[model samples]
Target: MSETKQSGSPELQWVRILDLDELPEGRVQTVTAGTTSLAITHYQGKYTALDNRCPHQGGPLGEGSIENGWLRCPWHGWDFCPHTGKPPGGYDDGVPTFPVETREDGIYVGLEAKPPRIRTVSDVMVETMTQWGVTHVFGMVGHSNLGFADAMREAERAGKLTFIGIRHEGAAAFAASAYAKLTGRPAACFAIAGPGATNLLTGLWDAKVDRAPILALTGQVDTQVLGPGAFQEVDLATAFNGVAEWSQTVLPSSRHAELMSLALKNAMIKRDVAHLILPNEVQEMPAEGKPATTPEGRVTPMEITPPAASVEAMLKLLRTSKRPVIVVGHGARFHMAPIVQLAEQLNAPVVTTFKAKGQISDHHPLGCGVLGRSGTPIASWFMNESDLLLVFGASFSNHTGITPKKPIIQVDYDAMALGKFHKVAVPVWGEIGITANLIRNELGAIDTVDQRPEVRARWAIWREEKLRREKDDRGRGINSASVFAAMNRVIPENAVIAVDVGNNTYSFGRYFECTRQSVLMSGYLGSIGFGYPAAIGAHCAAPDRPTICVSGDGGFGQYLGELTTAVKYGMNITHVLLNNNELGKISKEQRADELEVWQTSLHNPSFARYAENCGALGVEVTEKARLDECLERALAHEGPALVEVRADALLV
Candidate 1:
């Protein structure tokens, strides 16, 4: 410890920043004291401290050499006296100086006491976000976004928000999207101007298409250089036009709090992406004591009831049909309780689209697992045999194979989503929960046949088939069936599982049986690299819930750096990685199309070892016998964990 030397008033804080001999003769080194940057210079056997920023163009004098007895500004060659911070021409624009003393143990520099913190525009905007219930933010800090980043830092310190600094901005966006998808609330993703801003597009698109609420905060170049093609300048508003439900640039004269309130309101209300662009200068502008906006009177309860006539029409089909089947999608995630109750009232079998895998537990008496490509035969059989198809909160995507031939009753809150693809017998425009309850209350005694026995029979058949598949091994690697079977036995019932796109996800949908787990995915966009980052988001959104990620080698390889991110935050996530040593799904598609399977094979490092290197528990499962044990160990590990399964490419 260095002895303190107070050179000025009692407010001067003497902080020992460098050890003795840390600086040699005629050298300058940069140091920091309570957010203030200082350049310590040693000349003529004396030590001195000066403001690190050069008077000209705010360049760093500490990064320059003491050439010809003057500390030069590396950016523009502007020079100042090494010891006194004065220009040779006696110019008035000289750098400021601070008191420095060589003490017994080290060098001590005296800094003026930090002033009381003042709120900036970023604070007002960020406060509005928190008031709107944004609890988490993921992003990378860069030069342009420093002001906003500092505001988030303060918010984090205050425990009002949690900020996760991710490895890549794309991962940040994916994490935010998954956070929203799992929580039904918006989480913010931040990025700097130009490339950083553009990197968030793919994940934002995933949120946009899947109807997940997400807020994107992007930094921009100075407003003066916005249109002049300055460095790292892009027309962000135009760039985000398609993805964002609402996009605006924060201007000096804008109502900052109102802007943030509107951004978050639009995101939640529309269930889509909202963007705010912060210019470098405007983000640091004085707030002038403007109060942040809250969601007190801004948002309304969204339990919209269907029209009586529409409800009657839906009941007409339900009453007449003997075999009714209920299909759900990612949109029905929040209203499954009422939907499941209505399904039970009508004795209808409930099947989910791939994106809605865990909306209803596969073990439910009426549950028929996922439908379409990544689905069980039971779901397909039930859907095909049903006379009436009652789909709630589903878009009828072609991938889901929701046939239009059947008498369909589609329920959705968004009017545009009702009968979006083709015509339906009855289109109910209301909140899914309210509409479902209304239907159940009105339909007193329906003559619909009990589908529970048939659902049970179908599940038995599917499980038997899965068991048979699990037993078949061609000596290549572990099969996906056994992998998911182990996961079914090990993962927590209420865990949040983020699945990536590939054969592994296909197997997860086909084989994994859920109790009450929440599933997250890039539903419409079908993007890769979503799993691990999404697990990060899920853990952040609900830290109490166990988080799991299911990914193939190809998908996991995309954002492998995020493994380190999970370890850095000590996020408890069990990642089940299916290492087929290939892009198994694409290879299957290639063969189905009668084309050559080229560039589908992958060469990967041992992901288990990689996880260990990243400071997390790593377990490798090469045989089916060890699947359960490795999965159990990985799930039981305290921090982030990875269970890499070497699996047969064709077994999926």
Candidate 2:
């Protein structure tokens, strides 16, 4: 029997614990009564309920075995009266009781109403995160991070942030890194103390190497149990030593707001990972009325103009040169407009580093394609012919293969990146857009070579070569040229493409002609399995734009489970999976090194069927003729969709 509160008895709440048939008869089960856990016992064909904890040692009584007409505690084998929860004969200790009733639809448990939420340390830190424009969070919630997860829940409910629960911590980190890469803002990746924290290393390394800002929030064991090798405890600070620019532990004595401020500031200024450790004990501590921190005045404008001396030298070089070329990289993505305008003014052919493939459209009059191993002949021809190279934000990485022999002017915001590998003719320490604008404003019309006609001729020659390659089929698999040709026509102009490493990525660089699209990649790290996870991140960063993932079968297998992540969020991503059934890049490299292609083959499954199983639209294309039609259909679908294009392993 239960009594209803007569309008004043501590405002009550009705909570449905379980469906009527959820629990088997004569079984004891635990249910929540408001925030209090209750031991609901049903034995001898009658329902009885009490505290779920054993009074003796706080062992869970619901988990105890029912033996000889009494419930036996599993921890100490202590017995209690099954019906009234009274102890066996003269023992006063027993579980407390609460009123419960069986409704037609479900079981309901009654207890005092829950109290209003109290501000916690995690709340303060999370509030600081929201205040700093951390809109997207990707990670897995585990045992040690419960208190902090609850705070995130509250924030999500309040519409202050978005939390995506991922299957693997690695995917979470990659998603966060990709978000940062696309938006130039920090996104958080959460994990538990030990293995979870370590799983983030690869993706975090991607962010660190590429100079993208990322935040890591990790949970730890209780403060008291930190030392002496407690479960899930590792030296996280030392573990993240190389990756994070700022790593700190949140303690009860810590100035919660200030801790967050430092972490965020370091992440923004250095474009590095910032980490905060939350001890299990400290995460739930009451905030004591402290306010959260924000990014107001913490960030300064990053538009540094080139020094006058460097500008004059660069102008002199450009003016004297017969052929001038502009080479932009991934770091110049945000400031591409002015760079393109400068190219137009100079009539200079614009060739991009592989990472900066889409910054300059292939359709532009002065735009050449990617330059390097994954590059086109057009870019190579121009770079080889140019007398002066105006490099903006292009890291002199070996992959891009920028020639040090050429007379070059390199511009970057980071002074350390200037002449990082070798001496340049002019190392301008300034923001790329600002420097471009400054040079454009300062320069007068000079007699310089107009490379526009040559640019068009080179593009025409390359397109013919690409078309010829598209038709060279051994009947072993579909050629990559055909695949990209189809995608170039069908995919949206405003699409954000996330490309993975391997032959697929190389082909994308060489064959795909971009027009008004943005490309995201694991640039410096060159990590595989970055495509799909990065798609999730890019979609979150720009929900209005169409998100696409381009990956080979070898790379996609690394994080195939992320398809479910895309499905769960209803991300409108069209994944173009190149299924070659082998690591074609490795095989080709083996051939080049005069070594046997050992262990380069991969066993595969039908990825399209897998996508269908995950509640996404899936289409498999074995015929070269189906590329355009199939991709068009998948891209038209509003949600997550995948098209597995069977390609020849040798064709790429």
On TM-score, the leading prediction is 1
Cα lDDT tens digits for candidate 2, 1-652: 1122232235545567878777776687777665677667777766666777787667888887678888888789988776777777766776666556677877765566667789999899899999998998999999889889998999999999999988889999999999999899999999999999999999999999999999999999888878899978999999999998899998889999889888988998899999999998788898868899988878898788788899999888887877888999988989999999988888889999988888989999998989999999999899999888999999988888989889999999999999999999999999988999988887778667888889889888998898899898898879999999999889899999999999999999999999999899999999999999999999999999999999999889999999998899899999999998899999999999999999988999899999999999999999989899999999999899999998998888
Candidate-wise lDDT, in order:
0.91, 0.89
TM-score of each: 0.97, 0.94
Candidate 1: segments with Cα more than 4 A from true spot: 1-6
RMSD of each: 2.5, 3.1
Candidate 1 residues 383-455, lDDT tens each? Answer: 9999999998898999999998899999998999988889999999999888888888899998889989988
After superposition, candidate 2 runs with Cα above 4 Å error: 1-26, 33-36, 44-46, 53-61, 68-96, 101-108
